[model samples]
Each structure stands twice: as C-alpha cells, then as structure tokens.
Target: MVEVDNATLIAFTVLALLAFVVALIFTGLSVAKKSKLFVNTIGEVSAKYETDITPATYAFGIWNLIFIWQAAWLLYAFGSIWRYADGGPVLMKPDILPIEFYLFWISCCLLYIGWLFLWDREYLFYAFIDLFLLTGCGYAAVAYQSIALNNNMIGLMSKSPVDVTLVYVLVQNGTDLFFSWTTVATLLNLASALANDPLLKRNLSAKSASTISLVILGIMVLSWSLIENTVWFDYFKYVYAWYAVLLWALIAVIVKNYDRTNYNSVFSIVLLCLVVIALVVKVAVYASRIS
Candidate 1:
C-alpha cells in the first residue's frame, strides 16, 4: 500500500479545489448563456457538429443532475474528513476516496476542461481525444471504487447507518452516475468528430458513421447489462445508476430519431430499444432477487 504523505495529500486537495473552481465558473457561464469567447458556448459548438446520433436538447439537461449530485458528494466527502478525523466517532470508510480515485478524478476534470476549450475552438478531432481520455479516467476511477469496495476497504468499515448509506449512495452511486454520463458523452463526441472530420469519415458518409456509432453504443449498453446480471452479480452491487442514465440517453435518441421514413433512424432506434429492454429486465431481475 502506498502511503499518502502530507505533501501528497496537500497537492491532491489543491488540484481538486482548482478543478472545482473551474467547473463552477464554466457552470455559471453556461447558466447565464454567456461565453467569454463570442459564439463558443457548448451548445453553439455542439450544434455545429450535430450528427444523426446526437440526442435531443433535453438530453443534455442531465448535466444539471450530474453537477448537483457531484457537488453533494464532494461536499460530504470533504466534510467527513474534518467531522470524523482521528476516528472521532461516526467512522466512514469512504469519507475520503482513495488516492487512486482522486488522481483519476483530477485527471478527468483536467481533460474535460481542455475538451471544452478544444470543442469550442472547433478542434473536433482533438476534442474527441480529450473526451476519450476523460471517459477513460472516469472508468478508471469507478474501477478503483469497485476494487476498494470488494476488498473491504470502504463500506466494510462503516460505523453508523448514515455512514453505510453515504458509502454506497454518495460515493458509489455518485461516481457511477458521473462515469455513465461521460461514457455517453464520449460516444456522442466520437460520432460528431467522425462526421465533421473528412479523414476520419473516409469511405463512410456522415449518416453512416453516426448510425454505426449508435449501434456500437447500443451493443455496449446491452453487454454491460448482461455482465452485471451474471459475472458481476457477486463481485459488486448492481450499477443501477449507470443503467438509468444510459436509459435516459437512449430514450432521448429514440425521441430525436423517431422518423419511420429514414432507414438509419429506424434501424438505430430498434437497436437502442433492444438495449433499453435489456437494461430494464436486468434491473427488474436484480430488484426481485434483492426483495
């Protein structure tokens, strides 16, 4: 086990704080519908790259939920450090996430901030790369959280009901929600990048690229549901939050592409519907088993 020295801890805290400040500033600008660089707001930039797989405007509203949940978790986690330090009384295993988790999160934040800038500047390929890296970082953080939980490094040491709930609710659920959304966003970014970049499109038409990417995302979601129902059943608690956010994205896409006359739209809708059904059934099965 790597020991976290005072200097390392201080560095992590500063990075996290800096990331939080950047996020808040971006959020404020978004809420105000104002951009420092004229005509470079996220919505404005994304509209320029709209592809067949791009979800409807409402789908992006999920950022509100993501930001709120993330903020709540960060506050609780930070407060727990001062409130429960030295094992004062109400101990919480996940009061402070592991060093690996912080490292991954900080990297994700940096990449996300950079991706915004790149996307705003119309650097589609580079923006996609940044989003890809950000998604990978989110996945790594979630993976580490899973490992910590499975190894009895988090929830296992809880001392109170609040601690136990916070362990899984604020920590696990919060991370999963953030990661799942990022995964969807990454797929959207890839489709947009491919559609806009001539070299990346190659022999594929813009519509074809979007359709293929949509199918890929559908298959990915279905595979995850199947795995959670079988292989990961005992290893980790069901990732209900991930599936829920993904379901939201799929529904938004289906609503947007509800054109019966278009083959690409109809085919992609059917594939995504199948994936949604799989997610629903898997969640029902998990609930039944627990009940």
Candidate 2:
C-alpha cells in the first residue's frame, strides 16, 4: 500500500479547490451572462442548445447544493489531516481514508475543470467524455464512503454512538448525495450535448437522438432506484434526504416542462416509484426498530 504523502495530500487539496473555484466562476458567468468565451474565443451559441428533455431552469439549482457539499467534503478531509496536531481526540486520521478517495477526488475535480474548458470551446463531444468520467469518479467516491462507514460501524475500539452517527451523517450521506446527483448530472449533460452539437450528429437521425436521450433518462432513473433508494436506505438510516431532494428535482423538471409525448412523463413516474420505495423502506425499518 502506497502511503499518502503530505505533499501529495496538499496537491490534491489545492487542485480540488482550484477546480471548484474555476468551475464556479466559469459556470456562473456562462449561465448568468450567457457567455461562451473560451480559449481565445472559440465558442458556440448557447441558445440553440435548449431541448425538450432539458430540465427546467429551477432544476439547475442542484449545482448550489453540489457545490456546498463538495466544499463541506473538502473541509472535513482537511480537518481529518489536522484535527489532532494540537493534542486532542482525532475525529479522523488521514490514514483511515481509502485509496479510492484520493483517486476519486482528483478525477472529480478534473471532470469539472476539464469539462468547463471543453464546453467553453464548444467541444460537447469531449465534454460528454468528462461527464462519464465524472460519473465514474462519483461511483468510486461512493465505494470509498461505504468502506469508511463500515469501518466506523465495526470499530476496533469502542466509539460513542453520537460520534459514529456524526461521522456517518457527514461522510456517508455527503458522498451518497453527491454521487447520486452526479449520476443525474451525467445524463443531463449527455442530453445537452446531443441537442447542442450538430457536428456530433453525423448521420444520426432525429429519432436516433431522441431515443438515445430517453435511454439515458431510463438509465438514470433505474440507477437512482437501485443506488439511492434501495441500497443506501437499506444500510444507512435517513437516506430519505437524498431521495427527497432528488425526487423534488425530478418533479420540478416534469412540472416545468410537461410534455405528454416526451419521455419526461415516463421518467417522472419512474422517479415517483423510487420515492415511494424509499419511503416504504424507511417506515418499515423504523417500525421494526420500535417493535
């Protein structure tokens, strides 16, 4: 096992911070000013990129939550590194972090930073690649968090219930929520790319694009069911928070862009099922504990 070096840790922290700040500036400016200025001004018109499958304006508010969670994750990681240097109980030690955390952290930052440049330059195809990479990074982070959570649950030494719960809430839920939304963002990014870039449409018919978009939505809904609503809730308590926030976004998009013929209806219904499943499981678990 390669021990994580302090310099390497510093590099990861700095790069992640840099990526977050840069992505926020570019994304905020792009959305607010409708500017596509990139790499000495090679850009595309953003107006034509709008599509029926695109989530409503309000749905994009997810970025605010994602950014805040990412910032919180960074702070927690940093605190783990320095919390006990002054001789106090170490809430978390750096060595406890799974290797996947470092890998996922760097790749997640690159996904945001690299895609910003690609999108700015109107390279939708390349940006789509980054979106998939982002999904992979999110999945890796989820795995890391699961391992961390398990370690906390089966402590080699006794730990207070409150301490364990605090760790689980902060670490596990943060990773789950972030990953679940990143999965959503990946599909949304794909839809945006398909609509925006005609050059990527080479020989692809309109029916083909719509089919691909629907398929992406299908995958997104199914994954949310399997990952967020089922797996997470079955193991960790109070996973309903991720389900509720995500379900709200799904509903908001459907209400804002209602189309009977569009796949939005199907997606919304599937998401509704996920919401119900999560709730039913939560209530069952609660009743079982009480009994």
Best by lDDT: 1
Give the runs in model 2 whose Cα sits over 4 Å from its true position. 1-47, 85-96, 156-161, 201-211, 223-242, 261-263, 282-291
lDDT (C-alpha) at residue 52 in model 1 = 76
**Candidate 1, 68-132: lDDT as tens digits:** 88788777766554564335423233323567877898888878777767777788888878988
lDDT of each: 0.71, 0.60
Q: Residue 187's C-alpha lDDT in candidate 1?
A: 79
CA RMSD of each candidate after superposition:
3.0, 4.4
**lDDT by residue for model 2 (1-291), tens:** 345656565566556666667777766665554455654221233334544445566776676777787677667666655545324333433333455566786677667767767776766667778878887887777667565656545441353345456556665666667666766656555766766666674534433454576566556556655554445544555444456556766776577667777665665666567666756766776677657
Worst lDDT 10-window in candidate 1: 87-96
Judge candidate 2 at residue 177 and give its lDDT: 70
